[model samples]
Target: MAADSTRPVRIAGASGSVSDRRHAVSMFAANCGDDKVDVIVGDWMSEANMTARGVMKIEASSNISTSKSGDTFAFGDAGAAYEPTFIEAIEPALSDIEKHGIKVAVNAGASDTEKLAKVMTDLIKSKSLSLKVAWVSGDEVFPAVQKAHAEKRSKFENVSTGAVLDNWEFTPIYAQAYLGGLGIAAAFAKGADIVVCGRVSDASPVIGAAVWWHGWSRDQIAELANAFVAGHLIECSNYVCGGNFTGFKSLESKGWHDIGYPIAEISRAGQVVITKSKSGGGEVSTQTCSSQLLYEIQGPWYFNSDVTAVLDGLWFEQLGTDRVALRGVRGELPPPTTKVGLTARGGYQAEVHWFLTGLDIQDKARMLEAQIRHALRDWSDKFTKFEFTLNGTAGENASNQNAATVDFRVFVQAREEKDIAAARFLRPNIDGMMQGYPGSTIHLDVRQGFPKPIYEYYVTLLPQADVQHKVHLWDGQEIEISPPPQTKTYPAQQPSEPEATGVASTDFGQTVKGPLGWIVHARSGDKGSNANVGFWVRHRDEWEWLRSLLSVKTIQRLLEDEYRGKKIDRFELPNMYAVHFLLHDHLDRGVSCSSSYDFLGKNVAEYLRSKHVDLPLKFLNRGKL
Candidate 1:
């Protein structure tokens, strides 16, 4: 890549800690560098998270009327406005933000972003800081989603099932389209120090910073793609910093409790090096960086609101200590359509736990199920879900009592919260206590839990032309961005067979039937209903063996019970010596709808790691290689 006429830019990642706000803020403050970081960005918005925010607003609204009489959890709108995660997380870092001249960006402003911006401004004013605050708007596409069918512009069809939205089981609240960095770029160009967006793509902040700092245009697809990858790499903060990493054994021994957020040094010439703070814990290398790069990606063509990047040729290089440089990122014109995360009030859900101890656990579970079925025989049809899961198995001759106990859980999901909460619904098993099998016991919350509302996410595409992308500057100037006209789509690609390895030329190391974790590091997560599990090694020697050992057929066999002949796509990243598998509908359904034990599919990799595989003795001896 030829050098552009602009200097490089640096940005820090500070979120994916929406719920861990205090730690996020503290880490952000600790990561500030007066002469290093140029922009700090984070994203806390997601389909499920936004829906949860709406529920909080409704609950807070209900608490309002009672607050006038006394102090209530419902402080009303004030409570709703109270310390939003996006704004609140930055409060402790305000001083460092100004001192270091670091511009901050975040999408923590879920549904009530206007209020979030206002609260943040007031907080800034109280501190007597002259920070310019800007907020991106026009993400609200509810009106567009409602008329999508009538206008013939978009369809909310289930990606896996081909089911249309008209026959959806629940009522939708609203739809928010994923915006790109153009809005954030506009704000930065207009001199806004802080940018808050509602549903901007997670990597948009980094892209926006690069655009502003490097003075790049929309046509700089390669540069944009590089920055986009940089943003994606660090968007989840500690993820690339070894949180939930398969090689976390090293970090744990190093006392990585105060694991620092990462900082990316990006260049105008398309070079990016990801590094952690001087005071942080955790290490950054090619392995960790590659794990996150393929975190939620679908395939060769990765789509963002701004650009469609090609990751098939991507590569990474470790540059001394805790730094890794991403290289060979390429991008094509973005699709004409943008993805919208639509969520609706699904209904309500509740659960009860029953502990069955000792032997004959299966019989006890059967006995319990029969009694419950008999009690709810007439009302069984009322619930959307009525399930009994055996969460544990009693160990043979265990040293501890808990090890001999098996967990029997009963869960119910219904349209009405109170219906599941009915005393008759919860007390039946308790009513038959004496008739219960020997060693039967109940946990503290044997009674059904309080009703919790549910939200089902429906992801669909909307024509970008229909969305009005606007950026509001602190000075009341709103900039409208025209959507790029180019568009395309990528159908699922089939997995290719691995290249045959020579068993004759090479010393095929002695094999031992042990856990796969003994040789390889893995990371897995959900992409809608699909589960993407990626495994990589720290050494070049283990690449071929790792890749050849975990082909699609082997993966299917490893996860036989769960996969059950599902469509799975395999892709390899030679740059990172990694192989990834995309198992379709393997999660049963998505987070809200999935009946699987691992809802988000985060444990798929760990479960596979525990599976007995023919581990290469040589690789095991070189441990952490």
Candidate 2:
């Protein structure tokens, strides 16, 4: 088929993560409204997910003991090292996909693209469908990384901490570099009906589908940028359709049990209108779109393996019910290097929780902590880290027992399993329970008291030229994809001051103090050891106040419990009426090994929203958020 530049390409997002809804593909394929879906893209790779999958592959490899070669993994075996959830999600939708001739693309291959492709092919053959399956490779670079480290070719410094691999205590067992979408585009062009990929960027599937549908060249930066933004928006499926929106309370009446996935009708000129199936639940309003836009992002420059999307001027306009138009997205060439995640064995960790009920909550917690510390004093030096955390406060004037109780958690991590074994770690906490404060009792669940393995995820960048990006067609033909001819080098750190949207000074007469959430909404998530929280206002007039009030210092003060002394970066997205902050090294290590209560940082925004702050009476008079 020749390219149709005039017709818009409709891409439906089926899955966001490895554990996303299993029925998403079937729902999108059968119920995507009047405009049929041309391509269905699922994003299954993340920093933590990659780390877990890498560990699985390294453990499964027999060559790990002999050649010291990280390359010889057991990826050829069926059901080895790939996300099985993807297979489950796609099998039920195959009939609809075959009926509608809908194309499928997903980064579900994890550490093994070839095996995933084989599984898909076998499934299609079993169903007697004519669909062709292709897989993109070159993401697994463990052997190459080890060689580079030994030869001192690259420092592989931690992108977050700037510490070189030389200082790393754990051995590098696995590594996978993020690949671009050009390989996917090639597979699609070569007549592939389904594309399986390893660690391509999350948005690469959508980008590749758009590039193939519209016949876009590499020089088409503006259009590619729009596709990149569209991919980012819908890549998380229901996320843009109100899954994690701050205004979720407003959607309760409509129901959230079966929230709809998103579909992007991207035009050849790079315009996009996001919508969802009429039969599914959830709203696709501007607020929902804005929430997804701010998620897991770093400042105004959103980098992907494909292209750099400049989101400062981006705006979302609600076209109607379940329809939001995204515009003003500009593009720049991709960065010279792409992110590579290296996984290693960090150690073992365990935690035990004790409930302190009724009077003298603080005193009870202090007493319990002192007792546990004294009990573990002899073996404390064997542990690498130890911390005591008090969660919640006892209510005043009494309520029920559960309502009047607080929890004290004792967490510890060690380099060796025996250091945190039952005798050394769990027993001390249990021994102190009888000698503890009044009404002291541990949680019924004892599973967490046992030490579990921890995998530390280290992120660094690798030059695009070093990756051997390739696509394998259904017929066994392999196509090599070259790096983008035009590329730009971004600064190691974001600019101290992003170009502000320059709002005119205005002052309302009186001010009232209340929770910031009274007039503002927020969304937040983790990126490695860092967390990004973006705050936005529902009303346009509140933009100036929001941007003015939320400085790095103010955020530190608001989130003082966890982010007080942390280095923070602030940026503005004036068009969205949002101010974003990136708190550095907030999550101890990444998700796999973090000991923070809010391990994924999903509650960072909610925590900030709960804090009281002075708000303009004019905005509060209009309505509370």
Candidate 3:
């Protein structure tokens, strides 16, 4: 395909290190010389940087090296992972902007906030930079904000900033900090035209910018939400524009090096055009963009800003080359809830490794287990539970084919601070062996470990009244909140079931719930995929009430009736309102290891209508809308 000329160029500049931030900004500015660019985005922080930051700061003095990866575990004293410093990456990006006449936004607080803000403030003092810079604080910013809020409990609003941090009380894996476009919006209000953020969910930038540009109102949340969806689609930058194109293999292409950042041209009408750096690589076709949108879309309740984005009304269409438009986007009023990120002391963990050889893989596994069991028996009272995974030459694909060799890995844990004491005491598991097959191939080692704290976050809604929006402006900065969409609905009718035990019996069909209503799964598939849709029942209560009627006697009655001399099997689809009972061996375990679907079976439509033919008047009504 070709690129669109009318769209403003969206640029993505890369900075390999924090020191390169200025260079990255300069590079972006040089590329946009004398031309108008709508938005400038940068990706500075990564996962490895967060872990290292927490560990080295324990004593208030960091002995930690300034690198992403910490010490190694294999070579005696390997360091832990390092987190990116906020100031190191963002300050330069800001500096580059001052050097060049460019307005941009960045992910600053994603790594470290106070440090990053200090970097920005320092740059302002040194260069006399009067740039409009948006601050993207890391997840850590929330705790500090919350602490201040709690201290000013009675005078909450006095201490509370208009832009509230989410999931602060509950610690989230990785950075749980959420930026709902407020910081970027604040920066836009300041007229910097450039926003720098850290750890803001990928889509917040676009959503914030769109809301700022459109002059939307708070009541227009659905439009903001629709913009949020567009942001979600492109925030990963190239991910939507063919970077990880599942349909195509070769990602390498000319001009891919100058991959422009993604741009969402959102209109007040909820019209969105997802395009990328005119200089970027790959195609922005519907297939490419839509696939990214579908990535990890867990279910109907797509949670964000503590609000559930009902995805049913959302639709996508490719309007032109490199332009995919979104429509039918709508959102419900946000739940009056605020989920806080909380951090707490967790459990202690440790592990050991051993290599076994000379055939009898199962025997080797048993022998290793015996050794660990005996060692644990000696100090069994000191620990909670032990877990083992003996991997080696036992299965069809063995690591060592020459002879049956097994690599035994063992893990032990407890809630105590020094829980590995029981494990350390059992160190002799490596040397002590009761079996005679221990030959030259035997090797043992007692692994050492340190107590590392694991952090997690949870989401709980607070009353909408508890959370307030605060808009900070620099000079003439304005806040625009989009209005919700106007909604319309239509009634739908179910298809008539084909007659069973008749010539017109060859047929099949699938059931989907009407718009907005959730389909329920009475039972789940064993393998954790697909649900067995036995029959479609209307009322939500009918599904609940049917389970109560399924007694052991009902099975006996069915056996004595139609299924008397025939064989029958049952399966359930865990995800939807469906179940399937195979009449005879009609469908083999062909499709999904479990027979959730039947391609070779007799007409299931006929069977469902026949089975429930004698349904009570109430039962028939229950299946209807």
Best by lDDT: 2
TM-score of each: 0.91, 0.94, 0.56
lDDT of 2 at 180: 78
Query: Which residue runs of candidate 2 sit more than 4 Å off their true CA positions?
Result: 1-5, 32-35, 63-79, 498-503
Candidate-wise lDDT, in order: 0.74, 0.83, 0.44
RMSD of 1: 4.0
Q: Which stretches in model 1 have alpha-carbon errors above 4 Å?
A: 1-6, 30-35, 55-83, 446-448, 492-509, 593-597
Q: Candidate 3 overall Cα lDDT vs. reference?
A: 0.44
lDDT of 1 by residue, 118-236 (tens): 88889999999988899988787878888877776555776554567888777776677889998888888787888888888888999888888888888888888888889889998
Candidate topping TM-score? 2
Q: Lowest-scoring 10 consecutive residues by lDDT in candidate 2?
A: 66-75
Better of 1 and 3 by TM-score: 1
The weakest ten consecutive residues by lDDT in model 1 span 66-75
lDDT of 2: 0.83
Residue 414 in model 3: shift from native, Å? 3.0
Query: What TM-score does candidate 2 reach?
Result: 0.94
Which scores higher on TM-score, 2 or 3?
2
lDDT of 1: 0.74
| Model 3 misplaced stretches (Cα beyond 4 Å) | 1-30, 33-37, 41-112, 123-179, 193-201, 242-261, 278-283, 306-308, 319-323, 353-362, 378-385, 390-408, 421-448, 467-625
